[model samples]
Target: MAKRVLILSSSPRRGGNSDRLCDEFLRGAAEAGHQVEKIFLRDCTIHYCTGCGLCSREGRPCPQQDDAARIIEKMVCADVIVMASPVYFYTMSAQMKTLIDRSCARYYTEISGKEFYLLLTAAEPDRQLMLRTVDTFQGFFDCLEEAHLRRSILCPGVWNVGEIEGHAALQEACEAGRNC
Candidate 1:
């Protein structure tokens, strides 16, 4: 069945390892006949969450008038959500974290029943280094009912831009999207 796929690429650098993987994933998802959209965090103006609790207390809109609400709305509508980030100090990038935090306004209701995928890249070669990042994503998953983590691609040992080019993990990412 055709699905709506939303990809959040949180790499600060354009064409970075994780961003490249996101591109490949988009390609595969498109080829598989899914409607796909990729949002690059570097180009979006997402403000940090201030934790004012306004969203929770009064069901009010987030105080910050930025692109986050629109992005979260897209996330809410997607059947599949792919979060791709370059690992920084064995964790997801700050931009990705901020985006996740900004979803608090609709976390309880808008974000649910989606198939989630994680694409992480880091300088460390050990796959174990991504465990904490996975846990962080799982923490977000725990808040959303019926949301399932369908797959993850940890492309480690690639720090420099363009280093992910020609890597087998790119193909794997594409396959993951194609099979989604």
Candidate 2:
């Protein structure tokens, strides 16, 4: 039952807290014999969705020529999708949101039945601070029929880059991936 796992790391900062957790999750997933790939949004050229409605209108391809479509293709083929982001202003990063928006072309049909894992990090210590962020992810999940949220790791109080170097949540993230 090896799953094709895709980890989308949407941290603007390279090696940021959330990205670190993503790495740990990747490591654990790999150790557990899952086929894993981690895509860093910072390295991808994903443009913002313009709501042009072309994607939804005719089931046509997105007019914007960017990496978003390719990423969506990967998501469509993945059995498990892990979206990791640094909580920005109580929500997922713009990169993650934009990617989700751009998936309008095939989300309902192609992105169905996938297991999702949410990994988020924030400066706020209270886990409740991430509720809004979780809700944001849930909004996308709700659209994809049978796309269940399998797990969520909220690592709070880590703001600066590399701050999660020794955080215990890193291990928790790894364990989550291992158990996946």
Candidate 3:
């Protein structure tokens, strides 16, 4: 059966290491006959999630109108979700964090039972140190019922633009998507 794959690229820098990994993953997923969509969060008007209680009330809607609603809708419908981010300060990017925070709207309702792939690129050289960053993404999954962290690719020491070119992590990402 074909699956719906949603790749969320949260790198503010266009064509950044993590962004390129997302493309490779998309390529492999598409080649495998899956319906794949890659959304660059930098290009989307995703506002910071206001701590409003409207979504908690029945029949009340969120007031801050932005692209988060649409993005969350796609996340809810996706069978597989790929979240890619360039690690700054040893964590996911601000864009990715915003999206995760905005997901509070449907976290308790529909953000469940999905497979996730976490892709991260960091200037830090230690893989274990990068795992600390991956922990942030994993923490989100821990909150979701039946959320499966199917795979992850950590490209460490990739600070400069195009530093990740020809890196084996790209192939790993593609293989993970192909095997998805």
Alpha-carbon local distance difference test for all models:
0.92, 0.90, 0.90
All candidates' TM-scores? 0.97, 0.96, 0.96
Residue 7, model 3: lDDT of 97
Candidate 3 lDDT, tens digit per residue, 1-180?
789999999999889899999999999999999999999999999888787767766546667789999999999999999999988888889999999888887744688899999999998788888988888988888888899999889999899889999999999999988988
| Candidate 1 per-residue C-alpha lDDT over 1-180 given as tens digits, one digit per residue, 9 for 90 to 100 | 999999999999988999999999999999999999999998999999999999998889898999999999999999999999988876789999999999997855678899999999988888897888888888888988898999989898898999989889999999999999
Model 2 scores worst on lDDT over the 10 consecutive residues at: 101-110
TM-score of 3: 0.96
Q: Is candidate 1 or candidate 2 better by lDDT?
A: 1
RMSD of each: 0.9, 1.0, 1.1
In terms of TM-score, which candidate is stronger, 1 or 2?
A: 1
Residue 73's C-alpha lDDT in candidate 3? 95
Candidate with maximal lDDT: 1
Q: Stretches of candidate 3 above 4 Å error?
A: none
